[model samples]
Target chain A: MRLITTYLIGLVFGVGISISGMANPAKVLNFFDVAGIWDPSLGFVMGGALIVTFIGYRYVLKRPTPMLSQTFHLPGRRDLDLPLIGGSAVFGIGWGIAGFCPGGALPALGTGSVDVWIFVAALLAGIVIANIIQAAMARTTQATA
Target chain B: MIETVFTPFQSLFGGALIGLAAVLLMATVGRVMGAAGILSGLLQPQDFQDWSWRAAALVGMISGPAALMLVTGEFPAVQVPVSTTMLVIGGVIVGIGVKFGAGCTSGHGVCGMARLSPRSIAATTTFMLTTGLTVYVIRHILGT
Candidate 1:
């Protein structure tokens, strides 16, 4: 039951991304290219999602616990830090260059494009490398402490 | 120089569905529906239960085109004008950045922003600015 719910949720997200035309890198890039042939459609997508999510989160959080979980797994961090800003900036540059953020990229994989495969393979490698770097940093902090 | 036509109706509907998906994830799994975070978790899963759902979500995402095909009678367009080298470089940068930043579009942009989290707000703003600047430099300044 839990797995089914999760799968369905993913499906809904995938369908949403497809229907919104966000699965297309060209469309996404256009949104970022203000000086070029700009498209504000992506903004509407974000706005619509934000409005529904803002309301949905409120209602869902009011419950004592989630339907299938004992606790809400929300992020607890509130402090603004360099990693957050710097990392996001880097991510943005990549996004602008490729016009394929994870959300868009994941759904696009279904299109059977070799380029998507290449990007995803590279993304996985990057994720693994980042994990290694993060682990090393943690160990160094532990050693100093 | 290709034109991207406006799609307000479809965008809104799709956005709402995505929002609903997030809500469903929260309601059941009690987890935020961040795309990169979910995929990242799959790389180093803590347990079976954890791994199973991530796999399911990914499978669903990958098969999403089939779903769309069923509904619309054609696969959604996926234009990749970026070269292979750029795609790899961009993918790696995005992977590392998302890891350090702790979220991506679905996580920080949609879910986090909805929650009114300051960190997410900052992250979103910073990324948005950099994304715009990067595009401007690439398209306008560099004229690539």
Candidate 2:
């Protein structure tokens, strides 16, 4: 039941992304190219999404539990950590260079583009490397303490 | 220097759908809709119990676009201005960054901001600023 609901939601999300031009790399790139030919369309997309989500979260959190799950699985951390800032900066550079974020890239696979395949493969490799680095960092911390 | 056409109506309509999708996920499944987090979970599976929903969501994401193509008889036009090597490098960087940051545009930008998470707000700001700078350097300064 939960899986079905999540699937349906994902479906809608995918469709929304497709229709909103979020799935287009050029569109995304334009959003970041402020000094260049900047397109403010993505701003509206973000605004529209934020407004709906802001209201939705407010109403949903008031309930004891979500409709299907026992509790809302929201992020709990609030610290301004180095990883968060540094990682986001790095991600932004990549986003600007390639014009593909995780959300945009994933749905784009449907288009069967070779470049998308290259990006996705490289993305997976990077994730694997990140995991390895994280594990090493953890081990070092454990050994030190 | 490049003239580009903007689609305000399409963006708003699509963005509203994205938000509605997020709301539906939260209201029904009790999960925050983070695309990077969802993809990462599918990558590094630790347990089977949660895999079902994650997989379902991923399948839905992929198929949703596929369905649109089938219905509209047109695929969304996409252009990657960078070279293949640049694309690969960018992809790797994005993968690593999202993993380290624990979220991406969807997780931090949309959902995180909605919840008013301080961490997400900071992350989103950092990325947006960085992206702007990066584009300026690449497009204007480097002229690439």
Q: Give me the candidate number with maximum lDDT.
A: 1
- The global C-alpha lDDT for each of the candidates, from Candidate 1 onward, is 0.90, 0.86
Candidate 1: RMSD to truth: 0.9
Shift in Å, residue A80, candidate 2: 0.8
Tens-digit per-residue lDDT, B17-109, candidate 2: 888988888888677788888888887876875787888988888776787888898887667777898889899999999999989988999
Binned by DockQ into CAPRI classes (incorrect, acceptable, medium, high), candidate 2 is: medium
Task: State model 2's lDDT.
Answer: 0.86
Model 2 segments more than 4 A misplaced: B1-3
Q: Looking at model 2 chain B, which ten-residue stretch has the lowest summed lDDT?
A: B1-10
User: What pairs collide in candidate 1?
Assistant: none
lDDT by residue (A87-115, candidate 2, tens digit) is: 99999988888788888878778778888
- What is candidate 1's TM-score against the reference? 0.98
